[model samples]
Target: MKSTLNSTSESATAAIFLSAVLFCFAPVCSGEESSNKRTGEDIYKQFCSSCHVAGGNTAKPSKPIAGSKVLKSIATFQEYLENPPGHMPYYKTVVNDKSMVRKLYEYCKKLKQTQGA
Candidate 1:
């Protein structure tokens, strides 16, 4: 009777632990979190603002994004981000998909228009 009770207690503990772990990761795994809801501006502030501030590149002043040809099209912008040159970091993981790339591209284009560049 004692061994059976201990076994049941251990099984209950394991089940609770597994449930907690799964609950913590379920949102991330299912793509039902805020990461999917972040806007282009949010992404820019989080990842790009440090270097590309207000459409200007602090690292490479001559290559400001305000009027660059990279924003000519979504393909060009996505390609450049995935395989950037100079001091730019590769954003394959952050941008990750077409929707994210499109959002960033639109934001950059808007910046260019607003900045009159």
Candidate 2:
């Protein structure tokens, strides 16, 4: 009888643990699912517009992000954002993900193309 009770208890605990794991991962799965739905312009306006407006900001005197050569290369742009040289804040938390980086790069590229830069 004791062995039977222990087995049942273990099963119950395992079930609870599995439930918790699934619950925690649900949001992450949804986030990934919706990531592609966001646009480059939406991402820039939400995250980059604070510091970079109309491509450049007076505070830094840096080149406009829209037409900057670095923006042309996603790898270089992601690297720079990961560890910026100047006063620009690190975007490791925001645009660090591959999807987000791609979106931001495409947005800048579009801006550059449209502006004929």
Candidate 3:
């Protein structure tokens, strides 16, 4: 009876230890990857909102990104993001990742569709 109790206790401890290890090591478990993930709206609000208002109006003299030729595809969007013409500063760190750029692109597309642009 005592041996049975000991084995059960050992099994429980092992399970807990394994779970902790997995939680620490697993990518999804640690939330490291998802922490960097940004929604399309989030990206736009963070980076482009000041220049490009809702419905894609230009707050300044800059061209509106919504329905712009550059935003037609992710490739053009990324290219413009990296090296835009005129005075717009490069967004290397802000929209560094392709996924991040895609989020911004999707947001622009949605805005264009909704606003009849």
Number of the top-ranking candidate, with TM-score as the measure: 3
Candidate 3: 10-residue stretch with minimal lDDT: 55-64
Candidate 3 lDDT, 68-95, residue by residue in tens: 7887788887888888777566777655
Question: Which lDDT tens digits does candidate 2 get at residues 26-103?
Answer: 755555546667787878887887877766654465556766778758889887888776777777645547888898
lDDT of 1 by residue, 1-117 (tens): 999999999999999999988887876666555566779898888788898889888888778887889999998998899889989998765668777777788888887523323
**What's model 3's overall lDDT?**
0.72
**In candidate 2, which residue pairs clash?**
none
Stretches > 4 Å off in candidate 2: 1-33, 112-117
Q: In the order shown, what is each candidate's alpha-carbon RMSD?
A: 5.2, 6.5, 3.6
Total backbone clashes of candidate 3, pairs 3 or more residues apart or in separate chains = 0
TM-score of each: 0.66, 0.61, 0.68
Which candidate model has the greater lDDT, 2 or 3? 2
Off by over 4 Å in 1: 1-32, 113-117
Best by lDDT: 1
